[model samples]
Target: MHSRLVAVAATAAIALMAPTGALAQDATPMASPVGESLFAELGLPELTITVTDEGIEIDRSDIEAGRYLVTLNNESAEPEVFAGFVQIPEDRTLEDLSYADEVAAGTPIPEEGPAEEDFLWLYETYIAGGPSTVTEAARQVVVNLPAGSYGVWDEDPTSPRLAAALTVTGDPGVRVEGPEPEAAVTIIEEGEGGVGFSFRLDGEFVAGPQVVKVLNASDQPHFVEVSQYPEEITVEQVMATFMFDPSSGATPSPDMLDYERAIFAGWAGTQSPGATQWVIVDVAPGQVLVDCFIPDPLAEFTPHAFEGMLQLFEVAES
Candidate 1:
């Protein structure tokens, strides 16, 4: 199933990138324009929602008005599922917001979780698959205000990470870019025995210059660091350097490794499902290790390498 999804996604991406003559005619219309003065017209401040591997983030401090439009952009290669509502401190809650269009008829009100009353159902769609230029408008429902800090997050118990924020009287023009890249590495799980990880040279074993893109597909935020060790370093020596730790209360000692002078590091402070980072480095015929570190406090105070989040590669003579 996972492989099928990947294949479909790749195909969709290819179709989207195809030239006008080679593209299909059944392509759906992209998202509509968000409107020139969305903030001024709606009496709401401009808002931006950034989806990352760590979670969702809202630029403004609060939501003060009854009506507003929120724009969400997916910067990752996977689809993002948004389901929940904006929370306010008052005794009332807003539950009439819509995505692309109003909520489906008879959609039940969410009765559980942080933003229960403000339940909204938005289907999962690939951000990369949408038209290069797409603008989506979401109807902002009115919620009685009590003047307090409120936040938005995935309502699904399975996904409890916060995605954005709303401040009653905070600045409205704030804009947040996606997370930064800290490191580049691959993760290899070895079942129950243990795991192994390493870096890549040109995405394969052959020597040459390569560009590596690191994606945080996990629920929490993560960081990446690339370091080069001596050329004589062995694979075992390289695995000892990468580390990982989770915020969910899990800690495990990472097996370190050695590398050369060239290193690329990608870090995600709070990587939500759709967060990603990338790095480019050149490698000659030698060995390298790519490491992913996640410090989770709940499960164990350990890095991803301890949990087997590492990928190793060897560059052969060209």
Candidate 2:
């Protein structure tokens, strides 16, 4: 199974939020990026999920199973959180798979426990679309939630762990047809001498605000981290910053990745093979790097980019 916790530590810092069954009692209003962005054009139902120091807050607890414009807010003073909804196995209770206490205390989950493994399975297979990140502001993305009992938890191991429970009740319906995206991005497996991975764009990426459909076609789970860098920054320099001696067993510092300076566009969180998510990103024309930092367990938890899962492409004006 892919390790969400270690994905960014090996390359960069990325947090994937999962729910832990703690439900907020009342609804609260949070800023919705959707109101002023291209996401509003989709016209899907809206659900607000906010992560503060106290706990996970959802504007509502129950809803019909379908597509939603999920507004994720990381209001916590510290900690970058990835907010996504996940449905655990029917037999598993929220307590059994919750990461709240341990993550808050910064303690490792018991080695013999199934919580970590179970959470990973749920994330890659049972998750609906949620934003891969919400650092300190509100961002909106589209998620396809299905009928089930969901535990909403911030997936960042270092963040204050709080969970809210959500219940989706309805028939397992067909995928909610949405608007056609301006561009298509795919995570594909590239096996040459050995197994490999990479990202592919359907055509030239035009600058400015647009909708993108990210599809994971590979057998393994994957995510996309898109950033814009100065034209002077070479691919080798970015690669060097992420390079490390895995045998040393040291975590790479986030500073190394940030020192070079890149405008963070956005990311699509980890998704199971064949899963598809749509997100809105506004990017400027410049040298862009599309990379996957998700670690490959088979490669001793080495980040995917080390295996050539990165693409340096140009974003041109229309």
Candidate 3:
């Protein structure tokens, strides 16, 4: 009878050990080689995230069944406080994931625990303060999810630019579209001396006409304007007007110089960094001066003209 009892005890012990071993394997976190890095090539800063007292939530539904890292950066000179929690859709599947304030060598960020009202207060205060004081801050949230579309910013309508859509398609052949140009150029600054920009139109007094696109690769806002000079003029005359007083209002009378006119004048208005704008104009045969006029506010602190931000494109036969 004692031998029989020993056998039963041994069987129970083996069963307990089996479950413990399985649990240990399930608890281990898995890493992915094909996952996207938060800060790989695109130059940007780090960010922090938290839950606010107001219960503001961000929708995050599009992520593959793996791990992810969200990064936020402080673009302005002032310190900003962000309080909110990331919302995960019910239909999606996720795994062991965590959130952190600092990534690599960046500044350390703190996670504010679950609170909705407090988060709303913080957001309102920052928006009312404007870009001059509050500036723009970024946040990065990391998680593991199954494939779908995830919305990053939904709490504040005033902050649509912050909204990011994350799509997780399982196909390995899919590619992320790089930034492209919609217009020839954009004026980074406006007003007098700020930063005005212009583009060349390819139209002859009577010839082929086509619209070209210019793309803005910088982080500031920009626009484009078009102006035309006399069809029959020497290089010296063109140099005099561009190098000398452009706004002298000096006329090249019938005898002194040929008549020049501003045929098309359109601007791309203001474009945020990494954005594109399209400026269309009929091409004209002659020497065209594409000036990027900088508004006084932006030009007051920078020398964009001397630095060659202002370009002059020549359109001849063909």
Global lDDT of each candidate: 0.32, 0.57, 0.29
Task: Return the TM-score for candidate 2, rounded to 2 decimals.
Answer: 0.74
> Which 10-residue window of candidate 3 scores lowest in summed lDDT?
126-135
lDDT tens digits, residues 195-291, model 1? 3222223235345433344443444333333223444554444332222223335553433331223333211111223323232334556654444
Off by over 4 Å in 3: 1-208, 232-260, 265-267, 296-307
**TM-score of each model, in listed order:** 0.31, 0.74, 0.30
In terms of lDDT, which candidate is stronger, 2 or 3? 2
Candidate 2 deviation (Cα RMSD):
7.2
lDDT tens readout by residue for model 2, 39-146 = 676678888887777777899999987777777876766434556676767776655334566666676755433222333444344655456342211266676777
Model 2's number of clashes is: 10
Candidate 3, after superposition: displacement of residue 103 in Å? 48
Q: Listing every candidate in turn, what is its Cα RMSD in Å to the true structure after a full C-alpha superposition?
A: 19.0, 7.2, 27.0
Off by over 4 Å in 2: 1-35, 95-98, 103-124, 132-138, 157-159, 173-194, 244-260
> After superposing candidate 1, which stretches have Cα over 4 Å from the reference?
1-209, 232-235, 238-270, 316-318
> Model 3 over residues 1-318: C-alpha lDDT tens digits?
111111121101111111111121111112112123322333322223223322223334343433333333333222332221222344421110111212223533223222222222221111100000011111322222234443333222222123334456564334323322232322333222334323333322222232233344443323333345445554345334334332556654333332223233212222223333232333456654443322222333232232234444555555
* Best-performing candidate as measured by TM-score: 2
Top-lDDT structure, candidate number? 2
